[model samples]
Target chain A: MNALDLDRQLCFALYSASRAMTASYKDLLAELGITYPQYLVMLVLWEEGSNDEGVTVKRLGERLQLDSGTLSPLLSRLESLSFVTRHRSAEDSRRVLVRATAEGAAAKERAECVPARIGERTNLDPASMPELLETLRALTRNLRAEPAPVESPDPPAAPLNSHRASALTARH
Target chain B: MNALDLDRQLCFALYSASRAMTASYKDLLAELGITYPQYLVMLVLWEEGSNDEGVTVKRLGERLQLDSGTLSPLLSRLESLSFVTRHRSAEDSRRVLVRATAEGAAAKERAECVPARIGERTNLDPASMPELLETLRALTRNLRAEPAPVESPDPPAAPLNSHRASALTARH
Candidate 1:
């Protein structure tokens, strides 16, 4: 098999499996009027247990490993649905804090069935879950620990066009 | 810890790791002017080895676990980049075939470094990779094997609203 065979790549395995997991959650999450990513936010708020202080956008970003650019739009959608409310911190106006609303908290009850439903559907062995979780977590941790790439001083060259195509194609 | 803790969910772990993997591929793929998903398609095409009769769109969709709705736009983007060409099959006008252009095949050279780059970035142990792949593949298999949800005749009820909110919150 080619070393670059798509099936042989760990990244491909993770990518395919991840999308499969998300697709499995789609209909169930639709019933709760949320997407999979939105469900994740609710889980965080639910875990915080109705705290008035809530979580800062920065903290949520840190937890989710997403930047403001991505998180802002998602948070806005949740706010528009009235599932979440965001307000400037009283003590620090510059900081925005997010909390689950009554509706959001109530949504949790519907969500509680999700894990069991997924479990039944996938028939994933419960005994294997802890180990699987640990492996995935380690992978994420290692990937995240990499140093950021240094910016290239030069602009990227134009994509290879047809002139060199025949030679390149011949080699493959 | 709450059973529903965001950090505790297997789906979240997979989702987070998947995004982390994609992010790791970004700079490298940018150099080749392709997105991660697009790169996956190329990998499949490259594996098929420059045959004149390329894979059909239906076959591509099955291999990628993506429906045509998603694949159509992605294929268009790859076509625009001159990496792949799509044409109606002469045998069946309805069937569209996708093949890597010479440029696409050449890209494999640059892509050869990707797995190693990702390996170094993640610092993933080579010994652990096979077991990890097996676990993830099983997860995907089980998830995809699930029966599609039965459509509910009735529209979902409005969010639980305030009446049920306090009870749900208290229980948590």
Candidate 2:
């Protein structure tokens, strides 16, 4: 078997599909003056019904599986766009909270058309969406559950590229 | 129904799954000093059996669905690593071609271990992989077929934020 074949790799499949999906979202989002990741944050804030209290940076990070380094800049961009507001928590001065501005929340209504539009493009049976979602969610959960293996402290005697030659030679 | 709900979106599911899957590959790939996308390029070169003639940048772009803006920098980095060689095609000076180096070709042996390791992490039934791939491929095809709606040339009468107020007022 050609183990090196790209078509055989599930990771490649997911990676390609994800990028395609994001591309579909890109132009739609550009009209809203936001990126896909920014839209994701908006979804979270809209769903949480964030008000004056707002969602904390830490909580937003946990929900989005993003670190502060990523979320901070994103939030700042959203703030500059007048789509969101970020302020230090009154109860806890050290904690920062994020809330969608009125425009950000209103952007939701315009966004209402997004999913159906994307759905039409996919030509996927609406009936099958749940099944696909289930499979993908399970895959995500399983993959994220375990940590990747750490590199070996010691180096291999043969250089990395030699492995390809040895394997190919064996195959021939 | 909350159309804006993040959980209800298939795009979000695919987006999350893709990131998690890539994360699973990170440490495994780090040992080889390559990123996931770089590994993808290697997989293609190995499969094509690229020789001195090599694959053109344009051909590589089509296969990977990446534009030159993205591929150029990536190819340069790979060249710096000595995993791949990039040169102007003899027949066409205007066209640059990319081919795997001896080390890059040999790196395939080390990469042979990646799929099985990812499989173990996903814990997906081997029988189910083909089915999932088919579904994802279809999704990608469908999403890529349509162009996003162009933004309005004129500005709205109300501020973008007021759209939220109108939407919320209509809901109440």
Candidate 3:
């Protein structure tokens, strides 16, 4: 009942599963010569097919919950791969829009079967997917909506490994 | 319901939630001067508290599902921070053992409240935490257990964008 049992923490579970999910995409993504995150950007752009204005970089970041620091480099790589193109929006010089290149858009059809392959790998019930998705969304929303909880002010805190370990697993 | 719809993909959902969970840990982890992944390593070591014979690098890799390329640099950083020490095992020179320094072990007490803080942030019912953990574990297990599925060879497939877009949302 150790409080920090790696298996018991939701954070570890999420982290582990997320990494595993990424790993699962390795070979699949390789087919399209894009990394998983790159594929995600393409997904958004492909969904917006033929929107000449494409998606604003800001909108892409918002959709993916990525900051420009991360998104900018990723977009650049996608651009280098010819999977996507980024241009300053005509109406807003300050804004950049990301659209899939012909090559990138063509990858989508090949990508269509990607999810089904992943679905089979997870062995998750399609019927249950909706509920699972909802739970994850709720988890994300709740985590994002709140501030980090405050720690108690106390002297007996540090080095309580053995002592506090009892309390960590005691409740959960 | 575009298969490429960012909102609809389970992979994106997991990716977003995982990143959010990591973000939620920012302040909490900053207090410990460790990154999210580094904290995870500490969690494992702390759980093995006072074991003179600490965990092997191989075992740590297995436990964390991280390769040596990633784990080695991380361990080096932790060692440099004086939070951990690594040495070659007696019986197996090839096997390295990692143990926490007094500083790292003591940090565990302060970290005890971390999970509780995160749990509060998730706002998940304590009663249902176990189920969520199980689902995540199952997902990781399944994703890791399989090889990537094979794609069929057919020229009719490459440009199924507009044609297949109809089916992606239709099913899901």
Candidate 4:
């Protein structure tokens, strides 16, 4: 296959599959009255166990790989929907904490069925699903691995083609 | 594995991998002076062959799975960058045609090397890459499969819980 072929690009395949997966979640989540991102937030909170102190905003952002600019608004929307509540942590007033609300927690019972439904929609063999997950996990790990810092002795105003490529490719 | 566990959910895996893939493309595409989405547009245009009559906006949307609302601004940005040119098709004025400019065509040579570089970053065995690609393609195909029209005899203002789940699960 040609390297530039859209159909052959693994990046495009991931992009398309990710979007399709999210789209498939739409109607399922609509019943629960939360968007997919909100559902993700709920997942984190639900995983936290009910008695634990809520997660700090920074922690949630780190977990989701989303910056505050994106997460702030999403957290706000989830708050408005009564799916989550936010408060300043007692230990650090500067830090905000987020946790799923009672309504949000109740929604989980319904939400539990979502993954299996989405799984059935994918029509993937149960045996092969773990392999697919492992591949995607490995890909993400490699992509997120930090590039070794470039030690440019004579800093150019702009990165040259070789510099840019090296910066992108240096990560294992 | 718990279906809702953040680390275990295949959707989360896909979502993270997709975002990470785009992040890795940032520096490579920055050298080309295009964002990742813009780079995707260029890929489609490049694949149309140098002399094709260009692609219609609607056709481009269908190809990219983006709606006019999203593609309009993206196409406009590409035009402003002089990488692409758009005009009303002569045969059908209602439809717009978009084609790569000479400058855009020139970028393809540079872009050709990107996939291999990304492949290196992924660190997956080249022999196993095709299987991964096939898996992602199958996942996307199954997710996008349209649900059969529901023949609901009882008309209800809101879909019941079971109805919603059936609507989502019936696609496969």
RMSD of 3: 10.3
Q: Candidate 1: lDDT over CA atoms?
A: 0.77
**Each candidate's DockQ:** 0.28, 0.30, 0.34, 0.34
Worst ten in a row by lDDT for model 3 chain A:
A160-169
Put down candidate 4 lDDT per residue, B19-68, tens digits, no spaces: 99999898888889999999999998998846769988897788789999
TM-score of each: 0.83, 0.84, 0.85, 0.85
Worst 10 residues of 1 chain B by lDDT: B160-169
Estimate candidate 2's RMSD in Å.
Answer: 13.0
User: Which tens-of-lDDT digit does each residue in B1-172 have in candidate 3?
Assistant: 5666778778888988899999999999899999999998998888764676888878888888888999999999999999999999899899999999999989999999888878767876565566567667777877777673465443222221121122211221
Cα lDDT for residue A155, model 3? 22
Best by lDDT: 4
User: For residues A1-172, what per-residue lDDT tens digits would candidate 4 score against the true structure?
Assistant: 5789988889998999999999999988888888898889889889874776888888888788888998899999999999889999888899998988889889989999989878867776565555567667777877777332344454232221221122211222
Overall local distance difference test of candidate 4: 0.79
Instruction: Kindly report the fnat of each predicted structure, to 2 decimals.
Output: 0.67, 0.71, 0.75, 0.71
Collision count of model 1: 0
Worst 10 residues of 4 chain B by lDDT: B160-169
The lDDT values for all models are 0.77, 0.77, 0.78, 0.79
Candidate 3 docking classification: acceptable
Q: Compute the interface RMSD for candidate 3.
A: 11.9
Off by over 4 Å in 3: A148-172, B148-172
Q: Which stretches of candidate 2 lie over 4 Å from their true place?
A: A148-172, B148-172
